[model samples]
Target: MISSRSFVAISFAVVPFVFFACAKGSSLPGGGGGAGGEGGDEWSGPAQSSSSSGGMGGSGGMGASSSSASSGASSSSGGSGGGGSGPLPIVLLRIGDGVTTLSSAAAPVSLEWRLTDGSATPGAPGTTSMPQVISGSNYQLTLSGTASSEGHLSLSANGKYVFLAGYAADVGTLNVSTQIVSRVVGRVDASGNVNTSTLLTGAFNGSNVRGATSSDGTSIWVSGNSTTTGGIHYTTLGSSSPTQILSNPLNTRCVHASGGQLYATSGAGTFVNVFTVGAGLPTSTGQTATSLPGLPTLGASPYGFVVLDLSAAIAGPDTLYVADDRSPANGGGIQKWTFDGASWSLAATWNDGTAGVRGLAATPWGGGVRIVATTAENNENRVLTLFDDGSAFPEIVIATIAPLNTVFRGVAFAPQ
Candidate 1:
């Protein structure tokens, strides 16, 4: 059986560091190579081929017919598809005190929202207090402290609500070990206010809810650990209980829902657990875990992932972007995979010795896709990196916002 690892915490310190870049291309301080071989200081080289699995589409009641054909076709054409029109909104996870352990001294986490003008600069910080307001962005308001141990964030399909996953316990003197421990779910209106009362406690299995995503606004799927085992659970917004969808002892780390499918990664190895979500829930009772192609036999630990269903934009197939936190010595980097309505194939990989790649998000920019990633270095310094869709190497080091002595967790782009 795979063992679960505890979350690390960063020391307490407050430093505000923000840098904006407008250049179309800029290299890292040390110029790294591509994704495969060793380089001076940049990423290694492009991706290499790995093992493959038989098509799992038609097994376990998991088939592609349930996905919207029109949406898939539109995405395959590329560019902005269906509802991806307006300016892109950026949502970031800011964890205070950096600790994942339950404690009274733990500071509350916050979700920062800002709109981009297709440039690298983030919208200026709002002057108001708790509910910080971004003057000109679709997310007119920013919020924090609505949930404790909030490790992941996802917006509802309608863009009206934000779903959060993690554990929730009382703050300060009320904190205790016997407090509810589970993969909890919380919801907040997109109108910009952080209302703690809106958070739903004990909504699922009492485990550390590490990842969450919603296909439609009505239902949410969460992945997390419960003592000796980890599982994927589901619950509707405003509900008090979540039903266990799939249970495994693999130490699930993150999850993403797209194109009628749910993708989850495990910290135990390079396997990506895929599920067919039909009618807003898992169609079967188990997962179709597929090992990532092209990854070396050792040092491949998959973390957070994102699914880009360009089938609606380019009329092609859906793409999966996975962040592998393995050290540079073992080929640590980002891995790209393409699904042809069945199994997945290795597409590309990129990394620059900077391990701890956690969260991932992609948005339409300059008529193509722009990918943004978060890297937490030994839980000390957190860096946000950006890469162009088809670039040979990572394009820019957008900003380093973790100077506040906090570790960054999950990130998501506001629904377009």
Candidate 2:
């Protein structure tokens, strides 16, 4: 549970950038569009939801229990009892007030959760893990579609709503749910009723959107691709149509915002495109994009990027981490670049010595920063690996594990 003091602190912390962004699209990734993934080439921010329903069990609760089923499970997201059991795999992890939620995707559907026990880390000492039954509580809500390949459950700093990504061959889904209890004690009895889910729009809406990210929790920034007619569009949550910002047709992939200035990755091949937010895409949206000039000889082409404030930087304003998955033949690695507002130069390039590193995020753990990446053969059978910042070139693995059986596609992390 977030004490009043913590809530006030987080809100004050966000005051600096609250006015920098102008929301344009339908409901942000989260109901109110909770923020995540900020910076150029990054996802901008995480899902922010605004609905408040109490903690895991009720007001002042201490744990959260949630399950993202594969395709078709049960009405209540929590798995039922009477199945083979063994060591539970920690699927989804999120840090919320007094409660933390973890999912076990394997075996006879089950949700094992633990009370915070006042430990900052719920899975750590003095905590206890208990099985949450599907029919036991009114707070648990079952996901109807396939679990997200990204395997993340984003909770707002306020702990009002939960956001997750789910995708299928023909169906890709995103969700925002209310957290009614502290832990997944079991399924909320059917009679214990509550409206727990609200669906977000899909990528395959056939609307010519190339790439997109939630600018806030309620508005979406969708880029236009070769097939899309609208260059970029913004819609408010619950709105029926999008407001067009540009109409040029370009193969836009990456999207990020640094003030009112929006940046994208464009070009026939691969490049970074810069644009003014709410104005339109760059004039060179057709074929050219700003180049990083001094990038070291990275083996793979840079696929994605995120900007972070390295409190360790001597002079640079921010550091850029790019997913440079050289070719499979050459082995891929993530490269770092330093930016001082005007000039950008390479900082450190670490090769994982394996294949490639994609789905990168700057994770805050153990009071420090950890660079996380998902590695696999074309994103399949993926595993997440964590490394400390400024520790090495590629990354030094501290923890590694498989998230889903399918190819791991994307990864996102909320404040632990």
Candidate 3:
């Protein structure tokens, strides 16, 4: 049950990027820095290798030995130091018009990259354009074994690869009645090159696959909407077969993994479903569905959301932000909630008379957290808005970018 806006078929020209003949015999880049252990060493770049991984190292070529040395330093220093100063982390936005034409000439999904310096203050408005675009022809083919439409995207913890989940129709036909929609999972390396062997294809109850996330490097959790076959599904990094984990009859809009929990929000549910993910998979027991207090009952329309484990921020940890896509005039906005040992309570709310917040992401900024959300405007222009978690009412709109005629679906931060 993909949204009409998300599954619409459109005709548009492809955006161009410098194309390099994909290199041969290239090995995948090492997974980037590990999630820094609690009070242990901070996360560092992957150990460098002697052979070229592929393309421009593009913020991914630091030495592996350097990672080892940094870990040693952290062990000796008792983990007192903060994440070291380095190049800004890369922020990747999944871009697509959702056009699924099977004609010989059809544009595929693409990715745009932005560099965040980790210091943008609240209330400071700025506009930044993404400089790099990786087209579907370049990466999707390698990841999915076919040029399929891209839907939701997630970055692996180590930052080595981006996991994508979406649906694809058979090629060389335009008959909607004859189209076969199938779910696909794929990976792209730091160099923006796709890893062909990692392409995973299957079906999810005859519905377009939607949300996806990877908590650990081994397995990925995906969700879709189908009465018979949809719910939450999972598969390992190298496996094409998927095991349906949760078979609830809900239209899951997005899924995220953080702090040992897997959170999923449905476009038709009042509460966000939570599960304990152990060993990279959700445990079958102890699943809880929670909702924000004081919010009007959302009969069936909770859209995109983000979970912030801001243990590093001065603000209390276990913060969650859910985008309510009701019309902006009817209280459509983001509801901020915090877990107070026992349950989640509303902390704050912010919106500016504009609804359609469909994608959310967070990254470290100014020693705190910067939240980026996509607002789908009525005019079909998608607006990217930034906010500082430390701010109050009218939460600081640090930046906004409206990409022309595109509906931005998901946003992710690639570690520096």
Pick the lDDT winner: 1
- Per-model tally of clashing residue pairs: 36, 54, 4
The runs of at least 3 residues in candidate 1 whose Cα sits more than 4 Å from the true structure, single-residue gaps closed, are 1-87, 97-106, 115-150, 172-183, 194-207, 227-229, 269-280, 283-299, 311-316, 339-343, 378-380
User: What local lDDT does model 2 show for residue 357?
Assistant: 48
Top-scoring candidate (TM-score): 1
| Stretch of 10 with least lDDT, candidate 2 | 14-23
Roughly what TM-score does model 3 have, to 2 decimal places? 0.61
By lDDT rank, best first, the candidates go: 1, 3, 2
- 1 against 2, candidate with superior lDDT: 1
| Candidate 2 deviant stretches above 4 angstroms | 1-211, 223-226, 230-232, 246-249, 257-261, 266-300, 311-317, 328-331, 363-368, 401-405
Sort the candidates on TM-score, descending order: 1, 3, 2
Clashing pairs in 3: 47-63, 47-64, 48-63, 48-64
Off by over 4 Å in 3: 1-107, 116-150, 170-179, 196-202, 269-280, 283-297, 311-317, 378-380, 394-405
Candidates' C-alpha lDDT: 0.41, 0.29, 0.39
Per-residue CA lDDT of model 1 for 299-383, tens digit only, reads 4555556555555644433666666555533444456666766567656554433353556665444444545455534233443
The clash number for model 2 is: 54
Count clashing pairs, candidate 3.
4
* lDDT at position 21, candidate 3: 19
